[model samples]
Structure formats: structure tokens, C-alpha cells
Target: MTRTHVSLQQNFAGIVLTQGDPGYDDAREIFNAMIDRRPAVIAQCRTVEDVKAALAYGQREGLDIAVRSGGHSVAGASVIDGGLVVDLRLMNEVSVDTDARTATVAGGATWADVDRACQPHGLATVGGRVSSTGVAGLTLGGGSGWFERKFGLASDALISVDLVTADGREVTASAEENPDLFWALHGGGGNFGVATRFVFALQPLPVTAFALLLWLPETARTLLRTYRDMVDRGLPLDLGGGMAYLTGPPLPFVPDELQGRRLIGMIATYAGSEAEMRSAIAPLLALNPVASMIAELPYTEIQSALDDPPGFRNYWSAQHLAALSDEAIDVFIAQGEAMLVPSPSQHLILPWGGAVADHAENWPQPHRSAAWVVHPFGLWEDPADDDYVISWARNAVAGLQPYSTGAVYLNFIGNEGEDRIVSGFGRDNYDRLTRVKAEYDPANVFRLNHNIKPWTP
Candidate 1:
């Protein structure tokens, strides 16, 4: 091993890996199979001190640095070629203060860790749609989840964040301390610093219900219209979910013939019992579903119900819409029809508003004001089909451009361009975030994410 590699291992409190070392290949594996990178060093951090040591060694050696938790970035921002990766998987932990109605989660912890801890206490905060998603990455990008319509984004539930800056200085951001940095953390992503821990305000959630209803692909247009009309008429804040066109999963409720067949589906989550949930979604229920699964299960069970298996080549994009016109609905259906069937892809229309819009002005994600979001999530196994899948996802968003709010949710998309990054946060909020970036990460040491460059005079 080189002297530089030895030095980093000496200083770090956790394991370090180089090429050919045991577990090096496994450590580099991430959610998106399309991303294949070989970093020079991988630091498996176990503590905040290890994070500092890893950052110092990477900077001292002039190596590009990437921070990884769940390694779920479809853009593969968490790994770099011939650089250093600060892997935080060993740091996963969650501490709950039930009396305070809060959860302090380690940066490396997945939403599963948070949900499992909070579920026992009948408490929870908003979290990622996929249980395997990292807490820091999702919250930093303005977290979206099933509970958002009721409790707002996961970032909105943050009480404070403990971070280690680029220069290895430790600091805390909250409403009472470093408030500017705290404000920027709402949706600024990983541009500012490496978050070590997050304290989130939790709400009591004694009961929860989930329902998955599916119909033939031919019913998409009618189903879409009925879904839109129901949202337009004002659904309860306690109701949350989305509509999708996807290959049906091999579940008990799904017919054998339809298991791998393309179908139109609707998923609903209610913060109350199954009876209340049935009442809330009576309109869509009246449409007659071919397959259905409705149950009052633990919140953790519902969080992982839709978890997609990893190692699939993945590509996704989204468009926020102020309104879903009938013409736009036709475009959505057309795009869904064109998707590669017998795959894990989904063309989805998720509802917003409710608590999402109620807290719109409080954060940088102005897209929260959008009434609907069209997300094309592409996941397939064959590399030969890459072009076809990617084109379908892009075209799905393009067709709805006329009704788009011109803003985006960064977490829902891969690296599109710098312009899309700026649009993720509005111009004014982006400007403000740049100033904050200038203060905490002026040298731009953490630029792997949807970057916010430091302000220049």
C-alpha cells in the first residue's frame, strides 16, 4: 500500500479499503447498477471523528471526495473514480425521545431504522417512500413520502442537524443556532456539509392503513380522470398516495395472469383506521378494481411494501404541475402505454397540496405548491434496453411540459443539468443558498450532489 493509504488508516477509527482488499467491491456497490466507479480509497466511518479524519486525509492528498450513506443516488453522486469515498454505513443508529416526540437519527441510518424505532412509540415523522433510502440524503433534498400530505416534508420536521463541515469543524444548525445554515438545509442537498445526525420532530400516529387497487391498462384514462377529480374536490389531509401505470407485482392479491402484465394502479395511505381509509377513497373504489390489498398494518410494513429490489439499471425524472388538464392526462396515458412492459418501471402521478403547500414558503422547495407531480421511475435489468427505457422516462416528462410548474423535486430526478439544479430551488432561494454555501463550504469541497456553488462577488 502507498504511504498515503497507510496514513489514512492510521488516523481513521474505522476500516479502510483499497483496490483488491477484502470487501472493497461489495462496499462500492450501490442501488443503481448503471453506475460503475472504482474509487482509490473507501473509508467506512464509524464515528464523527472518523468522518473528520477521512475528510482531512482526502483533502491532504488532493483526491476527489464522495460521501455515501445508503448509496441510493440514481445519478451515482456518492461514488467517484480514482478518488475517496467516505462511507457511513457503519454509523447507522436511531435514538427516540418519546416524551419530546422526537427522533435523533444517525446520518447513515435508513428510513427503515427511523420508522422501526418510532413505530413502537406510536410516533413518526415524514420519511422517504423507499425504506432503504438514507435519512440525510432524503431530508437534505426536501424529503417526500406518504405522510407528506399530513405532516409536510421530512425536512420540515427537522429540529436540528449536527454537521461536520469541509474543513473538519463541527457545527450544529437549528432554528436557534446557525439559522441561515439551517434554512439552507431545507432543500440545498449535500452542498453545505456532511450531516452527522438529525433530530426530527415526530407526531403521534396511533394507526395507519394502506390500500393498493389495480385495474386493466385499458382503464387508465378513466382512472386518471376520476383520481384527478377526487383531488380537485379536496381530499382529506390524512389521505396520501399516488396513481401509477406499472407491471403488476407477484403478490397474493394480484391475479396470476396479471402478475407481470401492465396495469393501472392506485395506492392510498390513511393516517387512521381501514374504515376511514375506505371512506376517503370511495370514489376510486367505485371504479371496480381487478386486484386489491387493503389492510391496517404497521407503518413500517407499508414503508417497505413498494421497495424495489436493488441492482437494476435505474433512470428517473419528474415534472411538477400546477394542474393536470385532460389533455395532459391523455399525454400521461400515452407515455405509460409506451413504457417497456414486464419490467419494474412505473409511470406515476402523485398528489401534492395539503400540508405540502401549507409549508411551501418556509423552505427552498417551491415545487411543494404544485398540485401534482408526474414521475417516471425506470428500473430494468438488461443493459441493451437502456436507451429505450431512458427515452420513455424523458418523453414522459416532456409531454407534460406545457402544464409544468417549471420547478422540480431534485430527489426524484437524476443529474439533468445545472439549470435543473437551479430550478429545484427558485432563483431567489438559490441565491440565498449560494450565500450560505459561501459561508460554510466556500471552497466547494462537497460538490457531489445537486451542487449549489458558493457565491462570488
Candidate 2:
């Protein structure tokens, strides 16, 4: 190895992998198989000191640095070509304080880690729908999950965050300390610095009921209208989940005839007993689903139940809507019909007006106020169908432009462009975030994410 590489390994209290290193290939593999970056160095950080050492080394060596936690960035921002990756996978740790109703999670910890750690105490905060998603990445992008309707986004529950700044400074952002940075982190993504730790306020969630109901694709139009009407009439905060059109998986619960067929499905999670969950979704249940699975599962079980398998070529985009009118429902159903069947793709319509809207003004994500989000999640195995899947997802969003709020949730999308990034946070909030970015990361060292550029005259 080169003297510089040896020097970095000596200074870092963690594993360092070069191109030919034993674990280099596995270490560089991210969730999305489409990304094939070959970083010059991968520093698998084990402590805060390691993160600092790696960041300093990258900056001094004039190599681009990408901060990686769970490595779930759809755009593959966590890895870069011929750059340095400060990978935090080894730092996955979780400590729950039962008395304080809080969880202090290491930066690399996934939703599964958090959920499993908090499950025994019957406590949880909003997390990403996929259990494998990075806690820091999702929370920074305004966390969306099953419990979001009840407890708000995961950022709303954050008590503090420990970060390593672009200049190799150790700092903590909280309400009483570095409050501006804390506010910017709410939905600004990883533009400012590398988050090392997060303190999240937890809530009591002793019981969680989950129900997945499915129907033939032909019933989607009627089902979409009914779902929209139910949301319009006001559903309880305890109820959380979305309706989607997906290819039925080859699970035992699904009949053989429907295993690969596109079908309409509703997934509901209630922070209560099964009976209560059934009552909460009675309106739709009355419509007579062809297949159903309902149970009082542990919160952890519910969190990981629908974990999306990794190594799939993924392309996703979303549009937030102020309202879901009948015409919009028609448009959504049409998009669903056009989805690539027999694939893991989902044309989702999720409600967003519960706790999400109530705290809209508190953070940078003004799109939280939108009543609905139409997310076209495209996951396929073959690289040959890349263009078709990407076009379908893009077209799905374009079809609903007339009904959209001109805002978006950044986490639901890949790297569209700077305009879409600005739209994630409103123009005003984007301006504020740029100032924060300037203060902490003036060099724009951490520019791999949906970046907020450092401000300039």
C-alpha cells in the first residue's frame, strides 16, 4: 500500500479498505445495485474519532468524501468514483433510556436496529417504511413511516444530534445549542456535515396491529375513491399506512393465481389492538377484500415485515398534492395500471395531513402540509429495463402535475435535479438552509446528497 494509505490507516481507529482489500467489494456495495462506484478508500468508522480522522484525511488529500451510514441512498450519494467514503456501518449501536423515553442511536444504525431496541420497552419514533433505511439519513430528510400520523416525523422527535463538521470539528446541535443547524438538519439532508449520533424522543407504543388487505386491480378505481373519501372525512391519528398497486408477492398468504398479478392493496398499522385496527379500517374492509392478513404484531415485527429486498435496480419519484380529487384519483389509477407488473414496483398514495401537517411550519419541509403524496417506487432486477422503469416512474409523477402542490418529499425521490432539491424544502427554507450550509460546510465538502449549496453574494 502507498505511504499515504498506510498513514490514514494508522491514524484511523477503524478498518480501511483499498480497491484490492478483502472486504472492499462488499463494503462498497450499497442498497441500490445500479450504483457501481469505485472509491479510492473506504474508511469503516468505528468511533467518532475515526470519522474525524477519515474526513480530515479526505480533505487534506483533495479527494471527494461521501458519508455513508446505511448505504440506502437511491441516488448512490454515499459512494463516489475515486473518492473517500466515510462508512459508519461499524458504528451501529442503540441505547434506549426507558425512564426518559428516548433513544440515542449511532449514525449508522438502521430502522430495524432502532425498532428492535425500542420494542421491548414499548417505545418508538417515526422511522422509514423500510427497516433497512439509515436512521440519520431518513430523519435528516424528514422521516416518513407508519407511526408518522401519531408522533410526527422522526426529526420532530429528535432531541439532539452529534456531528463532525467539514473542518473536522466535533459539535452537537440541539434546541439550546447550535439551534440553527438543528433546524436546518430537519429536512436539509446531509448538506452541512456528517451526523455521528442522534438523540430521539420516544413515545409509548405498547401494541401495534397490522393488516394487509388486497383486491384485484380492476377494483382499484373504486377503492381509490373510497380511500380518498375516508381520508377526507378524517381518519384517526392512531391509524397509519397507504394504499398501493403492487404485484402480489409469492407469499403463502397470496393465492397462486394472484402471485404475480398486479393488485390493489392497503396496509394499515394501528397503535392499538387488532379489534381497534379493524374498526379503524372498517369502511374499506366493508368493501370485501379478496385476501387479508390481520394480527397484533410487535412494533419491531411490523417495522421489518415489508422490508424491501436489496440489490434491486431502483428508480423512484414522488409528487405531493394539496388535495386528492376524483379526477386525481382517476389519474393515479391510470398510472397504477401502467406500472410494470410482476415487478416490485408500487404506485403509492399516502395520506399526509395528520401530525405531518400540524407541524409543517416548524421545519424546512413545507411539503409536509400537502394532504397526499403519490410515490412511484420502481424496483426491478434486470438492467435492460432501466429506461422503461425510469420513464414509467417519471411519467407517473408528470401525470399528476396539475393536482400537485409543486413541493416534494426528498426521501421519496432520487437525484432529479437542483430545482427538485429546492422544491423539497421551499425556496425560503432553501435560502435559510444555504446560509446554514455556508456556516458549517462552506467548502461544500459533503455535497453528495440532495445538496444545499453554501451561500454566496
TM-score of each: 0.99, 0.99
lDDT by residue (tens digit), candidate 2, 217-316 = 8888888888888888888889999999999888888899988998999988999999999998998899899889999999888888788777899999
The C-alpha local distance difference test score for the whole of candidate 2 amounts to 0.91
User: At residue 438, what lDDT does model 2 achieve?
Assistant: 92
Q: Report the C-alpha displacement of residue 26, candidate 2, in angstroms.
A: 0.4
Winning candidate number (lDDT):
1
> For residues 106-179, could you state the per-residue lDDT of candidate 1 as single tens digits?
98999999999999999999998899999989999999999899999999999999999989999999999999
Error of 2 at 238 (Å): 0.7
TM-score of 2: 0.99
* Alpha-carbon local distance difference test for all models: 0.93, 0.91
State the displacement of the C-alpha of residue 439, model 1, in Å, after optimal TM-score superposition.
0.7
- Candidate 2, pairs of clashing residues: none
